[model samples]
Target: MSSILYEQSLSFKRPLDFVFTYLADHSHMSDWAPSVTSASKTTPGPVRVGTHFDIQMRFGLSDLSLDYHVTALEHPQYIELKGKGETFSIVERLRLEGEGDHCHLLYQIEVYYQEPVSKLVRFFSPIVKSSIKKDLVYLQKALDQQPSSWKPTLWSKMGDRLLLPGMLHFSKKGFASAKDRWIGVTEDLTGRNIVITGPTSGIGAAVARQLAKLNANLIFVCRNEKKALIFADALEVEGYPRPRIEIADISSVLEVEALAARLLEKGEPIHALINNAGALFNQRGVSAEGLELSFATLLLGPFILTERLYPLLKKAGEARVINVSSGGMYMQAIALDDMEFEKEDYNGDKAYARAKRGLVDMTELWAERWKEDGIVVHAMHPGWADTAGVSAAMPKFYDWTKTWLRSPEQGADTVTWLAASKEARETSGLFWLDRTPHTTSMIPGTRSAPRHQSLLRERLEEYSQKLSAVASQSFR
Candidate 1:
């Protein structure tokens, strides 16, 4: 056969961008494309005209390599790639329709088998059509499953190592790029019980709404009852279950303990607990109970709540504890000797960063501590989102980056993935951004010392023990 065309039409209930991005990216071409063992993009940036990829593919019983080029491209609509090997030249085209769901996809590929391979191609033609159709079905399943890891291009690697490009990835464009490689999130939470702190606003609210749509039984941890009720009502209006509101300030060890006690009494298996409640203290301050406000809210409270609720988490058999840290944490190291900012001059941002760093350290420690018990602990930063917290905490920074900032939904995406995705459960203690494992330390010496790691747990235990001795309020 001199020229053979294999074409298939596919329809999926996936967004056009979602399908289009998958088809255009070189990292995933091997995933759904038949006989491709590996594929790599040679050019940086999104797939566009003149982009180049080197491909390793299987040709019958022989190993073959091809140089592929992006010949044409259009957004969420069309893609065309042409590849040349020693004996074969191939062209693949994809066209998509519909907005975000109920999608229609057109896929076509033409292989020109020249000279030596022409005879072999003729013999394999019949089986090739059926196999191609099966691969198209596999493509739909891949889109639905949304497995997100991909080999980063050189530019993307630079984005992680460089300050400016790395920070740019925290924006909407970054989310879009990260989202492109995502396979899918197919898990449903109809019977799952998820606990989300600070769900009344910002990233937490976004996470809650997304999980609510998944039919997860959610417990909203909000400091205010009225806002919680209103948020729950909104979800109910969307036809999700009315979230069970637990009124307790996450900053209060006493309140968190009380709340944990109530959940323990309820004896429900908690599938996931999202410690998303956080604040950036501008002034050095103390909570009502005289604890350092930053430490209490960001470190101490989440620590105590996760510890006390260990039983509930273990009950679920496979549970995840997601600690929400911040990208700012990459700047600071854990201050073991001066954990409360007592010995050093207090900088609020430094304090916040330190607490987040400690939380990530704790995530590592506890993942090991609870691994035998079937509980996975993970930490994430919500990226830079246009949340009230950001506006209140860093007004000037917010103003400068507001347009580039991720929406609360984008901010919460990784956390939601961690809580609900099968892929997330495979690993624990790794810090993540954009559904990919990120370097826990961007700068030298930001990682906690082994000594500090030991002290973090010991000191937390000491605080809990000492507080229990003096705390007047009991567990809720």
Candidate 2:
């Protein structure tokens, strides 16, 4: 049987040294390569020709375990790797060209199989090629990013063994630096209008401050008129334009509707709508609409506002919607049936997490629904940021790990990055942390089922319609 070959060429805007170093490290392969659960260097010395890698990958439903040997290594130029399994053999090569600060990469793969396996392999060739193409997109993105603090260090490894587990589990700041190299935070936002909720304090305030410095017209949708005015005065003192403050309790569907209507009446383009006003109540409470407070504030409120402002977002031509969720969402999935937590006892933390998870689910859902309408929607977690909200809500936990926490600006870096960067607009419907896409679910039971997408979307639409109808009757 004839050997199958596939080829792809892509360019990385990063330095050749950066590209080569990142790819040459076997451990980084799994970060970009599809279905690669792990890649380890079995050799004792530095990476060079003859170095061996034990790779474990999942193909369809089968676990593929294989050993690959480096056949050739020419720094900043070429690399070739060969692997053999019981039924098949493989070879992959990379050709690199460096130009100024950019690198061009040419990747090629060849696969050969024994008699009966050949038929099966060829039959799957299209799928194999498609998978590689998809993986290459991820690889290119990986190459373009600056190294994050998530890189394993001796201290972190030791901490993993010795330190308290829960302390670092949700703390991205424990691993990620306050600054990001890939996404620039100082981009100009002149002539842009950015609407942010809960800008009086915490991560939302930090995000507002950063965007203001970039010359964006700031609109604060806040509950406390006094605090909103005070914060607006502070921004003006800092030489920022007087921020527009719209006082509305976001948890109230009527207020959310009123806020959106007021903004719509202004006829000004909305460059971005940041749904950042959210809180975890120590006890379960009800909104004006009689929905659970966490659910209403975190998910339903944002949904209604975004839905009402859909036309305005499209008017801006390339608007963005950013949902500020919490890393605490890792523990919960969308419990659609018990979404309001009416059936069981409500744990404050779990209630808060479920609300954030629901919002995250909607972020992805909205991005897909609105992509053709020119709106980019995304969701992100602050990752144990040292903020007043944390101190008040989880005082004991904050007191214990205060030193490990990131500053408000550090935690808001990804949010600011996503808000201002053109690169971030390239892809939508992703959960982000430290300027890169992160997995939405880290635990097995924490992911929403495939069917939950439409169900949640429909539910939010129903809520939006109900709220709009109420607002209409009140007006009449």
Candidate 3:
């Protein structure tokens, strides 16, 4: 297919977020687009920058799936995406404008054919126009009858209980369904200071982006200044305030303590502290602090950081501490006796899961201990998110579940909700997934014993003392 640029413009009486969200979501593509037989988000998350989709369209005697990648996006304002197939490629640009009761949409698309498909390009132009025109009619009709009762439906909840089907809720479809009940965060966070560890990528980056969008004062705890600067620059270019960076390797207890000291020295009243830095090491390794890498990063680092920041959290009044745990923790309980995995073979995933389990237990303990301090502590599982950590640490699992894994944004959703939502403000000490409180343990074997949380607290306290003593000696 040569260059036949197709352009279309439409006006609607709906708000931009409404129209844009509807069009951007690919799950219901077959409902309005005649040629599209099926469509699904191939990537995790809602349609936004970096999201991908697979669209299958039937044309007379042939059908093909076009894999689309979103190249650029500016919220509800503008979007550009490209789709490639076995025989051809396509470019699509969607722009939205106006506000309140009226909105304007400009849709542009172009198609290119390769090799054998080049000869059949002549007959495809008319088909493209007809498809778009028909799509507009059905789309408007569908929008006119759009249901407002998008509040929690029962079928999806049933999916949450079943094992195989429950995995579906970990994908983009689950995020889309969860969006049904979203009224969206109404709070203006202009003066709210939120601290996020590991804000350079994955769920931490996503959560940071959301907070920036809400105008919160952001403080990022990053190990690499270069990556943090690049990420902050991108945020600034996108019209968000550049996040203030605090350098620290959260995987090392010494660095974490120093990071906490610097933050406390500033005396900023932190509205929310998100302990999101973590990694799954494929092989067992120990930090300079002598703690196992996974143990230090996932549990001890966050524990020390949160403990040192207690006064600032109380100063903010009604502060929040959101610990980003993982669904993998459901498989492992806290190996209190062998936290470093020194007695047996070191399987990285199991070590990571155990640390996460301990982190969850500590969350409940902190919530109760700090309840009078006006600091709410909560733990949440991101639910099989596809991130760089997953790809690097568990390639086999990533390859098997990549298509269905939750995007960084989807994984970060509950974290942002816990940080900003009024409903979340009413609760404490719960393990959450998709905005609802969930059981701390799914498997019976993973359940903590009566003394487990106590031991976890005691051990972390011991580590805290060691960190403080080491820091004091270094200062001397």
Candidate 4:
């Protein structure tokens, strides 16, 4: 009987390590593979070659269970499995490749039927192909939903691989020396009081911790009061000065104003405001302010907060405002007219991308306007960090790309450097990746002007006024 053959290749936004790890776990088959309703190990653990499992699959009204065994295991490269059942046998292979900030996955399958059933297999080939294709699409969607923090077995050593070259380069450049690395310099932050949003977890938490260690008095703003307390306590335990906890929902302009008022009462000059809290919703949702949740969380909220805090930032000497954006901004262009998705279909990923692009534009605008105040503003994409935000939000993507994802410590390294390092002190109105300045992914000649930097000031001022108006109404 002729065997049915299938092959498919897909580009995933996650890292190569993440792909390998997620596919390597037999237990997770049901998580991404749509046809597989459940997968259980027939052998103990460790899916080495020859390890077997039982997988239940549902195709149309027919429910089937197949005994599967790992036929091939090559670390960080490929996995092949074969499933045997009463009258059918199936072979599946998953191949993975790492691309910069993305992963490529190739899935191939073959099926053989019993001699008598072989005659019917030809007619069923299309059905089989359609089912598998549907499965792959579902898998891709599943991965896109995975968070940056999802741990795949293959990513355990990713940090060692990712940092080796960078660390070696830095070491060769004499980064260890205090004088050479600009770690010891204490430039006057006389007017600067930093407001760090989402200071409780992931890159924000790490940045806050590092700032506290540097003896920077910070107002740590977050929604979770208990988590904030825990974080403050952790800092105290680590011998870092405890930053004052300011409870507020950054998505709400009113909360931001209230928090700002409390800080103003303390009479501290605001120097830097790190708008770092962000969300990636897999499904469509709206915030309390009636704005699309991702838009509100990432762009609108930060915009309003910055406007409310602009006076304080201007009062500071050489103040800096760092906006945390994402590389996902490259995925899509700005939907200016339908920014709020009020009249259009909503997609979480596109919503996030739009918000981030807006953020980048806003960063450039603010940097240009605030230049006179010595307030250097910049936006940064914290490298793919292994944080809960990634794991929980994008499990399938995390699983597939975990291999190339950086640890939270490694990801936050650039953010911390931008926030405090003297190397970045003089540099403003730029985007940073891996602690080095880089240009944005914006293409020339969109709805906005061709030269992104040139038009930033005007755009930012316009957006700032709009956001401020929103805040004023919301607060009242």
Best by TM-score: 1
Winner of 1 and 4 under TM-score: 1
Candidate with the larger lDDT of 2 and 3: 3
For model 2 the local lDDT of residue 179 reads: 26
Can you write out model 2's per-residue Cα lDDT over 103-172, one digit (the tens) per residue? 9999998988888878787589888777777767667766665333333345434433443543463464
The better-scoring model by lDDT among 1 and 3 is 1
Q: Write down the worst ten-residue block by lDDT for model 2.
A: 177-186
Model 1 lDDT tens row, 1-476: 48779887878776776667657766455545555554666775446789898887654566689999988898878899999989889899988898647778888989888887797876887766665666566677766665656445565677768999889778866765565466545455889999999998999998897787567999999998999998898778655688998999878767777798789989999999999988899998887568888999999999889998999999999999999999999999988888789997889999999999999999999998898998999998878899999999999999999988877877887888899888888888888887777777879988887678989899988988777555544432
Candidate 3: misplaced stretches above 4 Å?
1-161
How do the residues 235-273 of candidate 3 rate in per-residue lDDT, one tens digit apiece?
A: 786556779999999887778878888888999899999
lDDT of model 1, residue 177: 57
For residues 398-471, write the lDDT of model 4, one tens digit per residue: 89767666555445655666666556666687877655555465344322343643444344456556655776
Ranking by lDDT: 1, 3, 2, 4
Tell me how far the alpha carbon of residue 470 in candidate 1 is from the true structure, in angstroms, after superposition.
2.5
lDDT of 1: 0.82
Residue 251 in model 4: shift from native, Å? Answer: 1.2
Error of 3 at 35 (Å): 18
What local distance difference test score does each model get? 0.82, 0.79, 0.80, 0.69
Query: Considering every candidate listed, which one attains the maximal lDDT?
Result: 1
